[model samples]
Target: MGAVTPPDGFTFDGLVAKLAAHLRARGSLTDARWEEALRAVPRHLFAPAAAWFTSNHASAPRGRFALDDEPAAWWTAVYADTSVVLQTDDGAGDPLSGKGLFSSSVSAPGIVFPFLELLAPQKGDRILEIGTGSGWTAALLSWAAGANSVISIEVDPEMAARAAANLRKAGSAAQLVVGDGVKGWPEQAPFDRVHVTVGVSDIPMAWIEQTRPGGVIVLPWHAGGLVGHQLRLKVVNETTAVGRFHGTASYMMLREQRYNTRWSGHHHEAAHRSTTRISPRTFWDMDLGAQLLCIALVPRVSWYDVSEDGGDSLLLYELDDHAAEGSWAACDLKAGAAEAEVTQYGDRRLWDELSSAYRQWISLGRPGYDRFGLTVDPAGIQLWLDHPSARTWKMQT
Candidate 1:
């Protein structure tokens, strides 16, 4: 990859224009309004003076780039279509130390634009945005819809304060509320749209109740795993909302909705051990939609980890519902091995269920994200393949 040149004069406006042009050239800024919004709201104003660059395996940030120390690098990062980490370890650890999980961030333009495109905001539309990280998305929403028509909620007070300052700096008048987003903001009910920036384990009923009957809700939905799917649900009536997966992406889970109980390093004596011809790659190499199908087929099973034993041998763990009394399963595979060893403990056979789900997915012609849809109603959430009338899997209540 070649280095991104700082715009002539290295001015903020120059950088903004350059970024907008880049996004347009890359086909991410296809919508004229969204392109204009990108031009209007400068990302640098919302990004922290000192921000961290993150990678997939990075537990913590490798280091921080201070604008004062490296203006060119900082400007390039802020303008680049990539996510910049703002906080780590739930805002408890040193980001420069390179040793914590990312808590908050300015999502990359690549992911952000698809969401805005799917949202398809219109003039005079009232929008409610969840997860006001860095206030960039809120500012974008304000630009898409009039500033007075958008309300953004954040859970962290400090983050909220920073977002408020950023919004003010960007001259955005969008409302910023510091509160849990799971409840949705009812004071401004019947909103035409609801956009959740954070990943949610379940579709909150509050969001459904607060939206107008015909309103749309766009969010990164993940049951209990790493990868998340983008869902664009339309409120059909007071009790139901249905939609199909528009795309695949991942985001940090909402703080209040995070799962606390997790599998620890322990092997149960009652674990049933067996060998199967199924390669571990069946689950490992699945696309985002297939991974999600595994979750839907076996609700409450979460992908744990994959470990290598200093050689070609690999171990994969899948944990059952956190509250399921430590139920878990592990599969051992070796290079060039024809069969993989599988072990299951606790009340549920997670591996068996996963294998069955994989076979079922194959029978369905290995559908993509667009082939699946979700229905939320009074009873519970249902995952359907092809159409709602097709085979459906009921999620745990």
Candidate 2:
């Protein structure tokens, strides 16, 4: 790799170099080949002309930045270690318009390199990449695995086209397919690795079937309705894959696997109401370990918290509701109160399940997220602590 010339009308004054050094210092850009790829594939070339900025995952996007409109700010954000939202509400609404979900983004350098490190693609390795959001990671994978070794799938046709153009301009030979990534691109089966860029609630068996034995699949596992986890699984055979969690990662949920966030309009006239000694903070303030355990023990739920009336309130929504339609729960933590009021509006009693999961986690010695591992097979996915067989529970498939 020689000197990388910046795109026309853009001046990257060692910014990629600076970004590389930053990732290295942060211990994410450890591989020499990956570092070279980072230098070769300038992120600016892949970034969109207009995008939204957010300081961190916890904060909402501040405002929009356009390359032609705000060159300096756009350049700075492109080089900095933060995600840039490419579209919101599936391109129907502006990101900063105050009412739209973040549908696409160029993930921060911090998260991207870590997953790439976990992928560890080898030269000439056939790689299948899910969610070719900005085409940046695909380019990097092509650089690592050599030309024509990467096949990337994107669900959104518009995003796919944009990514295809970006890959072409970046000189990456990675093939781009505009289709649902959950299906795993069967035409190109037996891939050496599967790299997912979106959050997956359920591990698609198609991925396992497409991957060659001993192949690795790395993704952001969305579970427990909390912040996701970095999951790295090795295909043990045709029917099974097992791996452990690396750390916390949050990404946009895969479109096909996305949970319904809209409130189900049902009058809770006869809904069960109760009180619990468990405070709302117990749910909202749970560390990553507890959150991961809850994901295993109390699967198929999403939660959100709010500060209200000088206290915290936690709301749980059912994602896999079947018999008990629209099961939901709300727990309120009044300041300086020992017990919290709980309300259940469906048959599933989500709050009770959450409390039970929390107690189970406590009884198991409060293991951290690192101690847990996932086993995905034809029967179902299972979560275990310490060892694969040591205390396992079937996760909602």
Candidate 3:
């Protein structure tokens, strides 16, 4: 056969625009800034290899292939509008450096957009961000919030420097500091908003101290027993704020604080061999709902570990605490059948409480995230849902 020509001619720009429009159509992108960021920021420059990836493992564990390894594949994957794991548990992918497992990645646009809307920073408002893995999110924040208003702290120096350079190339001149992001940059304290791209087992109280009262601080809150929840704190006072799980996303555990002993302490020796039948989707949905319920019941951790056996599996949420909590398989996938058996372990009977709370919420008409209003009182915080029932949790005064 004659030399194969490239499939038609799909320029990277065209592909990027197509993907951006796709997201826009879904209402995933609410602002015009998405296209602008897509056009302005150099995704190829940041991820030249551009691997093809998909989160769904319902079929099989078939993903994580590098495009650079195959030119045609890379060209297509570069513009797919999906999260691609750049580095794994091993390390960066320089054959010379050896292919490390994908522990970190550029989060999907779906996840990033919500937080962007939630933060809602005007161009002039100063913003601080923690965890600059791919720098893509920071670029978006800089574009919408203004580079001068954006000051991001990245714990991984290598990733931080790369992100800084990428930001510069994107024309976003935000201050990129190479340091531990958990500390919350003292110089940039009192920021209008602080968003963390990575997950954490514990709330870095410093984040609260640094953010201006009434400011928003968004991060993945991880607790032991494998439950991760999103937190959006609106500072009521210097010492405390009230917030709830906005949504869910996954991130590799931070280097120093990977486990909190509460999660990994009690491992099901036969976990890999556990026999349970559950429709993949139903099992996952219940597990997903269970995850959020647990977040509401036992808010902790900032990472995820998803698994499946035939059609049955568990969605294990984790905290920095050694305890890893997981939602039980509620379905036997062999047939369309579900049995709600939420397991509770650790010092915390985490899953049981979560499942029970979910039933209670259902009894109470199942209020959405908007129903949860965070009110700051002099002593601590009061999470008022539906304006009638309120849960009071203390914040350091």
Candidate 4:
């Protein structure tokens, strides 16, 4: 945010305008308020001078870009519509090496503007933002709303400190609170809007309790499936909130919402084997709606596609299931095979569950993502198609 003269041809203003045009062409920068906010906030100020950037191309190499070492590259990446990696391995690994878990970063402008438009903060609305990375989004929210009308929270003290310094430089009056965002800042209760940057697996009752009725909560939810979704929920009561999925979003999970990745090979040994008429593609090639249905009905189950013996297969892992441990299933995906092989282990029959969910989707005519809606209430979270009272699945919060 500090005054930094851009290299002759790479004027910062020019870069901002060009980026805005690019986002507009991509159909992301639609709202006038957000476009103005984007012009007001300098993304380069929030990003590190020298850090790694996520590659838009799948085959491109990864490494760090520094203003001092590579000004052109750094400036180019700063203006481009890609996320810049701020820290890796929770700041333990060398971020300059461009290798490690992307713990945090300034989000890509493409996603940032879309989500901000979804939030639709008014001039004087009080907003609560979770995961204040780089303080960029907080500054944007402040611009759309009013000065000091936004309260942003960050769980990491180090990241919070950096964001605070960035905010000062940007002259953003948005208050930064260093704490767990899942708790939802209660001291500033009854906010008009709640905006979350991190991916949420479990819906917190505290968020519903803090927002006044008719308020809105927008977030990227990891609804127990291969894909994550962007959601907008309207607060209907002290204990209830409802909304529908907007689009696909694959964000870094909130620290607490992350699942255990320690998988053992022994689970495959004591498995029950069967053949399912359902193709592995039923899960692997599922459209957004089908995936949402599977995620809703089959809770706490995560899946991935695998290739074995020149054949494709889908693997499922049971997460947070107290009834059993090391629960998993593998379904063969041989092309044009009427019945594929399935191997399931532990107390949970994951293949059976997925197959059942797929059948239900067929019976209901296989709706798309728009037909799926989420509800959070005193009775826990529920996912339903069409209407709230219709066929619904209770999600674990």
Measured by TM-score, the strongest candidate is 4
TM-score of each: 0.89, 0.90, 0.71, 0.93
Q: Rate the local accuracy (lDDT) of all candidates.
A: 0.77, 0.82, 0.58, 0.83
Better of 2 and 4 by TM-score: 4
Count of clashes, each model? 0, 0, 43, 0
Candidate 2 residues 10-61, lDDT tens each? 5675767777787888786788777677678888788777777765433223
The digit string of per-residue lDDT tens for model 1 on 285-372 reads 5776677677787776665446476212223244333443565777777666778788787667777887898788888788886788
Residue-by-residue lDDT tens digits, candidate 4, 1-397: 2337677678877888887888898788888767667668888889888888875334322457888877777887888887888777777887677776767888888788878888889999999999998999999999889888999999988889999999998999999999999899999898999999988888888888999899999999986778678899999988999998888777888887777543333456679999977778667778888788788778878888887776778888877633347678888867657788998987778889988988888888988778889899988888898888897888754
Model 1 / residue 167 / CA error / Å? 0.9
Pairs clashing within candidate 2: none
Evaluate model 1: give its TM-score.
0.89
Pairs in steric clash, model 1: none
- What tens digits encode model 3's per-residue C-alpha lDDT throughout 75-107? 455455556665555354642222454556767
